[model samples]
Target: MGKYDPLGGYLRRLKTDSVDLGFAEIERILGAMLPKSAQRPQWWANQIDPQGRHVQTRAWREAGYDAFPEAGAERVRFVRRQV
Candidate 1:
């Protein structure tokens, strides 16, 4: 959740359906995973290629990477939304 300091607050707002309309998609995806007590939240990691093309991390997104249950003790938790 680096550079995502506001993400936790944003997620809290989103879970209660208090998010602005611009965050609709994010809300929907997280909401769909509500049944799982422990979820691997998805992340949008940006990468710049040698050609300067910005690419979002599709693999992590698809895998629903978990920032919680953690890879290890040094891991960081991500924002959670009810969306």
Candidate 2:
């Protein structure tokens, strides 16, 4: 499990094609404000740790979801993978 496992667990409990949540909602799950880097696209990319494991991306992928930021919006949209 990674530090962001809470986000993954929340995503797993959702049953929908997509969900749009405000930064506040995400912070609620994270129990803290998002880092400034989180607003950057690179932060969402699959980053590898020194142990050769994906950090943030592992959470969503494990929950069968992917998150994308809406252009000019303050919310993030998480989409479920098509089976």
Candidate 3:
């Protein structure tokens, strides 16, 4: 499993349609520090690379959520995607 799979499972199990989490909270769930690129909003975008390199994005997307990073708040809001 990929490192971010843990996060996917966590999100998938949530009953709420939305969750707001700090970066530190995510690291706690991941047990690994996010990359420096994570500071950029683009890093949390719901897009993917052609080679499937964006594993983190895949994690949330697979869990039926979309991540939206707060501007300069060091937080992210995950909204469950509509079917």
Query: Which candidate should be chosen as best, given lDDT against the real structure?
Result: 3
Rank candidates by lDDT, best first.
3, 2, 1
Comparing 1 and 2 by TM-score, which wins?
2
Q: Point out the higher-scoring one by lDDT: 2 or 3.
A: 3
lDDT of each: 0.32, 0.77, 0.94
For candidate 1, what is the TM-score? 0.19
What TM-score do all the candidates reach, one by one?
0.19, 0.79, 0.95
Candidate 3: residue pairs that collide: none
The clash numbers for all candidates, in the given order, read: 3, 0, 0
In candidate 1, stretches whose alpha carbon ends up further than 4 angstroms from where it belongs are 13-15, 21-83
- For residue 60, what is the lDDT in candidate 1? 25
lDDT of 1 by residue, 1-83 (tens): 32222333344443332332223333354443222322332322333245633222322222333223233222333332222
